[model samples]
Target chain A: MLSVMETSRTHDDREREAALQQLQDIERAQAATWLDHPATPWWWAPYFAVWSGALVLSVGYLPGWGSALGNLALVAASGFLIGYHRRHRGTWPTGDIPRELHRPLWMLLVGAGVVMAAATAIGFLVSVWVSAVVTDVLAGLLVWRYERDYARAAERARRRLP
Target chain B: MSAPPEAGHEAAPAPLADLDPVLTAPKRLAFMAVLASSASTDFSFLRRHLGVSDSDLSKQASALESAGYLTVTKDGRGRGGTTTFKITKEGRRAFERHRDTLRALLG
Candidate 1:
């Protein structure tokens, strides 16, 4: 004779078809969630690009002697922004660093500050054109490096997500 | 018709009649649905997308683990530990069964 539990198990088998239908409904709902956030990637690129371009153009337009000093300031600002954005996104690449090995991000800020000061002093004591060229080169390098780093970080984040 | 003496005794509790929907609660179901559609997901990725608390996420994950629905692995190091989760074959079957049951009920 079949027990009550055994009978219920048989009923469960009969219900299997219904279970599959519900799963499809759930899957459709989940897919809709992705569509809702579709504009996000398209918006981020143009916004960031405009801000970066403005920063470069502002410093690049300075007079011969002032150009280098302006470029150095731009570099420092760009580095700070890059660090800030990384920290904001919670994607800072310090995950591998041990707690004891951790150093304040202030170190990066300090290094940038020193570069700016050196550029300013050189502009005052030597030729402005020479200072401008050096500062612009340094600024351009910092910005380029940060852009690459940020792109790599974004890619890693994408790969980690479902 | 007269019932037997054994029939007069208390009947066994029904094997969870509403198991389909209950098993696939919105968040857990959503988690599995996402995993089913994707290759895998990491801890922070799921956390940010699902907008659930760490403890809540852990609890839901534990429930799914007990059901043999997912495999969760912890990789990387320190406070920034990386956790990866993937749906299991048994989980896929359970999800399908749950959906089938729901469809039958609706019909």
Candidate 2:
């Protein structure tokens, strides 16, 4: 690496300015790489689409207990697989984000929970297809919406910091 | 001495005194930047990303580790082993301060 920033205390304004400029360039390059880098691979998108679709389809086509069992199996299997994969990989990311950025995500979870609760309540009083529309289509849309909105909010908050 | 100005990390140019020399080095700074973004990063990832030699990366990592800025862990045995690096809380704080200080200077 360049020792361009290793100037001494005797350095003048011009040299200091150059170092600062270089630092800015470095920061910009790093930021670009950081933002563009995906935590998951491209295949993850299709995985999500297929899995969610299957969950929704199951809720609509299967008997109530069958749907419940399928959903339960999916959740349990997903949890187990993720844990197993990470454990074996050893270098899997901890996926930590600052607690402040988590505020909106937590709220989003609460909102999703409320929607899910409403869907289950509706299921008790209505047909599986009706509940599936709420739980599947609307809930999926809500997640996507919150993901975009909350991510923007988090970026804003980070920028606003001193 | 007069007290330092209190507000605006963006508008006011920060003094060089505020910058941590530990993270000011190019390689170490880059390593810390990556660490700050990720939960943990492998030594190889950092090496490949920075395009630095193993010894060169090791020297910088050693400095940062000694300074309590990053932790270096050996994940396995012998040649099969992988080295992992994670930033300490203090290291993260210093990295953030260094970034803000640089930005302030840029302005």
Candidate 3:
């Protein structure tokens, strides 16, 4: 009897079909829930906006000490974000680390810093403010790029859903 | 992953034998679905995510363990230890086969 039952559905094919559909519905809902909930609860947009705004505003109008303090704070925040991400990388259901994520953004920041440092050491060569403007522009571009990259990754993940 | 059923399964409903009983239960299936997608997950998080009571979750989880579908590790010592559950290779294969067979049945 068990073998026969295993080989075929019970006589009520309609009822069996209904049960199958309900199971599929439940399964899909479960998949969708897990899909949306990544291990790392990344809330990037607002944090990026607030910090970047403060960074640029401080560089533009804050007193020298105030600007320096603001920059220091921003650097600390960046460090904290990296640390938090690393903490979750291996331990949680976040899966593999996206090795390519924000690569361009990090490189841009590094390149901008290197160029700015060289410009300042040359003794009033082009203009002091020019270097700051260039770096600030690069940072703004990074903010934009990060958002775009995150969106792309999210869409790619959605395709794997049930 | 186990090879999906050959083309004939599309016309006839997949045999019940094609399904993995351990993966068929709603809660257990949900558990495997979550674990299959990750390296590991905290016990508490998985239970909450499955929306099952603690004892119920523990029972289903233990059944999976006994079936060689998953492994449960109790972190630290005995009581009050944090538990972490990870799906084994067999579990991953079983889940993929079950999922594919399920799709075939639905068709």
* C-alpha TM-score for every candidate: 0.39, 0.54, 0.51
Off by over 4 Å in 3: A1-91, A94-162, B1-11, B77-80
Q: Write the per-residue lDDT of candidate 1 for residues A1-162, one digit (tens) a residue.
A: 569857766765555544555455465434422321212233344434444444444454467767677667767866877654433332222112222112323333554566467567766787555565556566545444444454454444344332
Interface RMSD of each: 9.7, 4.7, 4.8
Top-TM-score candidate index: 2
Model 3 local distance difference test score = 0.63
Tens-digit lDDT track of model 2 for A1-162? 124433422254564676676575455324422332323333433444345545655766678899899899779867976764443333343434444446667877887677667666777788656775666655666656665665575466446431
Predicted complexes: DockQ each: 0.11, 0.19, 0.18
- By DockQ, the better pick of 1 and 3 is 3
Point to the candidate with the largest lDDT. 2
Tell me the lDDT of model 1 at B37: 52
- Superposed model 1: Cα runs more than 4 Å off: A1-25, A32-162, B1-22
List the candidates ranked by TM-score, beginning with the highest: 2, 3, 1
True contacts kept of each: 0.22, 0.23, 0.23
Q: Between the candidate structures 1 and 2, which one is better when assessed by DockQ?
A: 2
Residue pairs with colliding backbones in model 2 are none
